[model samples]
Target: MVTIHELFQNDGQKSRIGTTYNKILYVPESVLQTIREYLDAQSESEYQGEDNTIIYTAKFPDGREMDIKCCGCQEESSWTEAVLFDEKGYQLTYTDVGEKFEGLWELEYDGIHYCVDVKPERNNSKMED
Candidate 1:
C-alpha cells in the first residue's frame, strides 16, 4: 500500500503523462479560494478495488458540487487522477478532459482548494538547453 507522501512524489515526476503544461491560464484568486474552502469541508472516503480509485466530494460557494478521486495505479504509479465537473452539460469521462475547455476549473482536496485553468498543458516547443 502507498502512502500520501509517495503519491505527492509520484505526482511531481515529469514523465510523458505528467510533463509541463502546453498552455497556461489566468483566473481570480477569490474563485480559487472558494473552491479550496469547499473541498476543505467535505467528508473523506476511499474507493477501493483493483480498478476502483479513491474519491472525495466538495461543494462550491455558488451551491455547485463536484467529485474527485486519486487516480489509482494498477502496476506503475500513475499521477493522473479522476475528476468530475459539476456544471450542467459538462460531463467529464477522464482527467485530461479538462484541457478541452478554457476557463476556471475549481477543485478541492483534503481541505485545500485549487483552481485549474483548463488550457493546454504547456510544453517546450523548442529544444531545451
Candidate 2:
C-alpha cells in the first residue's frame, strides 16, 4: 500500500517557484510488483533508469497512453513508490477502495492539497473513489 512520506514542508521553496512542489510517498515493494505486473500484462515497454527505478509506458489499443514510474528507496530497504501519468502528463491519483494494494493520494502545493487518483483499468476519464 501507499503512505504519505511528508505532507507539507517548505523544504525547497526558492527553486520550485511556479512548477511542481515537493511531495513524496512511501509505497511498498509488493504494491510496486503488482503495478509492474499489471503494466507488463498490458504490453507496456520498460525504460531503465540510472537509479533503481523503471519507467513503463504504452499506448493502448483504444489510443490512450499510460506512463508509470517505480522508484526504489535505498534508505528504506528497497521499498518502491509509483508515479503514474497519462499521455498529456497529468499525475494520476491513487484511491483506497478497501483493497490491499489500492489507496488515494493528495499532493500539497501552495497550501492546497490536490487529489491524484489512479487511472481506471478501462480507457475512461472518470476518477476512482
Candidate 3:
C-alpha cells in the first residue's frame, strides 16, 4: 500500500508541490524486490550499450494483470531517454535523464509534469492512475 506522488518544482521560487494521481497499484513486495534486482543488475552490466527492453509482470488488487516494459540505452552518456508503456501498449510515461542538470531528472506522465531526484523504478513503480 505504498503511495507515490508526482512532484513539480518552481525554479524561480524553488518551491515544490506534490500531485497524487489517485493511482493505486496492488503489487507484491517480492515483485518490487525483483525489479530492484533487475535494475541493479542492468546497471552493473554492459547491456546498456545495446537496445534493451526489460519486461515484468504485475497484478492489481482486483486481479488485473499487466505487462510492464522499460526501454533505454545502457551507455554512459550525458543524457538518455527511457520510455515506459502500459499494459495496453500506450505510452504511460516519459523520462529524461541528462547531465544538463546533475542528479536531477524530469518525468511526464498522464499529461502531468514531475521533477524527481531518481527515476521512478518500474512502470511508475507499478502504479495505476
Quick one: best TM-score, which candidate? 3
Taking the tens digit of each residue's C-alpha lDDT, what string does model 1 give over 34-65?
A: 33333332322321224744333433443334
Any residue pairs clashing in model 3, and if so which?
Answer: 48-74
Every candidate's CA RMSD: 18.3, 13.7, 10.6
lDDT of each: 0.35, 0.36, 0.39
Candidate 2: where is the Cα deviation over 4 Å? Answer: 1-69, 73-78, 82-101, 123-129
Top-lDDT structure, candidate number: 3
TM-score of each candidate?
0.29, 0.28, 0.30
Give the per-residue lDDT digits (tens) of candidate 2, residues 37-105.
Answer: 533332223422236555344332222333335443323322223333444766554322221223334
In model 1, what is the error at residue 17, expressed in angstroms?
A: 33
- Deviation (Å) of 93 in candidate 1: 9.4
Candidate 3: tens digits of C-alpha lDDT, residues 1-129? 223554455654443344322223334455444444444443435333335544443333322233334333455322334344455656566554322211233444554443323223454463332
After superposition, candidate 1 runs with Cα above 4 Å error: 1-50, 82-84, 87-129
**10 residues in a row with least lDDT, candidate 1:** 15-24
